[model samples]
Target: MENVTLSEIKRTPELLKQVESVPFKLEKGKRYLFVGCGSSYNLGYIAAEMLNKNGYEADVVTGGKIVALGDFPEADVAFFISRTGESTETVLAAKALKKRGIYTISIVCAKDAELSKTCEENIELPFADEESVVMTGSFSTILYMILRGIKRYSIDGIEGFLGKSFEYVDRLELKKFSHFVFLGFDELYGLAKESALKVQEMALQWVEFHEPLDYRHGPKATLTEKTLVVMYSKDTAYEVELAKELKQMGAGVVYIGKEGDIEIPYQDGFETPVRILPVQYLAYKKAVSLGLNPDKPKNLTKSVKL
Candidate 1:
């Protein structure tokens, strides 16, 4: 019996290919703000980092921050991201941003979502929608769509990449590991956070995410033989050393970089959508090893509605 989460993960490359032809555009010299919750928030965070790195001004704020603290950044345009487009805080934040006279755009995987209705413009990717509670393919699809808005890309060789990544994950002795840690920086940091969320959501496992160097500051105290560290590296010398250090501490390490256990060359954050796929597969495999169903995570719904 295959899980819906696995099915969705398997379909991601096709989804990316389909969305490549879809046009989404962004204007230059305009400050952009992104709003969302949970996985959606992580998506926005990565978008902001990439955009800023590319000379565009962008910032991301969690929908909860806007709804709870009444905090809003000044921007000519704001993008509200929600997979189902019904997340309560996101809708509320979109409404608030619209009220303040900023143009709002809804990037969602659902058709005619409430968040879409509230925004001045909507970028809907219904084709990327998923049935499972945990986000799999849709997350990558939406992120790819947004990245395409800035720079055109063809996800060439994605099939081979997926095949290799899944095969690598399959070879892991997943049951021996209880704690999972993901490390990265900047746009990769957003990916690291989302990777932790994937394992925590799908496998109900202990997980953590941190910037590569910051892990040594205070977090490495808990490292043990049962810990597995997934490093999303920028090919930095310091990060390379840290991987060796973590390994010496008896923690199993999966370094992801130009030369890594799972080699994924960083491409100025353009490769993020693809970079996330292996970790998604790892989480699904871990859930299966623990006799949990990744298709239906505990205490979660497809969308978080108020």
Candidate 2:
């Protein structure tokens, strides 16, 4: 795991250099589309949010949607994410977009993948060729790289963030949680989803992800003393209130960012998605502690051929 993360971290500079040199135009009126599968799909969701937050009109949709929907809105660029760069739906979606004269930019780990061939430009990471069926360092590293790119931050800033995040991961003891639930709102909604997936996929536990307020609507019924709710608190006051309520309900809630009065050291505030890494790493560590191999989750594969 360390090797995978280090390799990916080491490649950040080169990845940034490549993306910086890509010849493309991002106009204000142009729409941007993000497409991927599974974890990569979740990464696309984050990418779409980042793009939108940065003043670009962006939307996230699954690769299947792109293929089935056929004609899509005219866009300046489409960002396609696929870890293996071989997901069937993603490849087909890229091909579909290309047929429509849409410029496609791929974010993949496999530089030589078929999907890469279909894309006009691509950002490849070092976290390629996973040995596990469930994605771990690969998912986080790729997403982190995209986040850095979206923020247009310098490589130094990115490296500093990565260093702190790695330290946080090392300090956490994840085996304590018997069950876990991830919560977030708005942009962090995708973060919550990815965190929940990490827990379930890496830990092989039934973990749930929900909107902070939405949890009270119906999902709260499943809460108990045994359930560990990991909440990603944003800048909104409503989210803080929701976290407080959940804590009152006897649910062990760990707030991700320092927005609310109930703060955890792991909370670095909601400005960045790196705050979610602790829980992700914890889930992986917990799985390993339980004698489970997170690299190959049960009944799953690195790439779904169908």
Q: Backbone clashes in each candidate structure, one number apiece?
A: 0, 2
**Quick one: best TM-score, which candidate?**
1
Q: Which stretches of candidate 1 lie over 4 Å from their true place?
A: none
After superposition on all C-alphas, the RMSD of every candidate to the true structure, in Å, is 0.9, 4.2
What does candidate 2's lDDT look like per residue over 129-205, in tens digits? Answer: 45456665566556556555544443334445545555655654454457788887656778889888888877788
Output the lDDT of residue 37, model 1.
Answer: 91
Query: Model 2: runs farther than 4 Å from truth?
Result: 1-27, 68-74, 127-130, 148-151, 154-176, 259-273
Query: Cα deviation of 214 in candidate 1 (Å)?
Result: 0.9
**Tens digit per residue, CA lDDT, model 1, 130-240:** 899998899999999989988888766788889988988899888889999999999999999999999999999999999999999999999999999999999999999
* Candidate 1: residue 86 Cα off by (Å): 0.8
TM-score of each: 0.98, 0.80
Indicate the worst ten consecutive residues by lDDT in candidate 2: 261-270
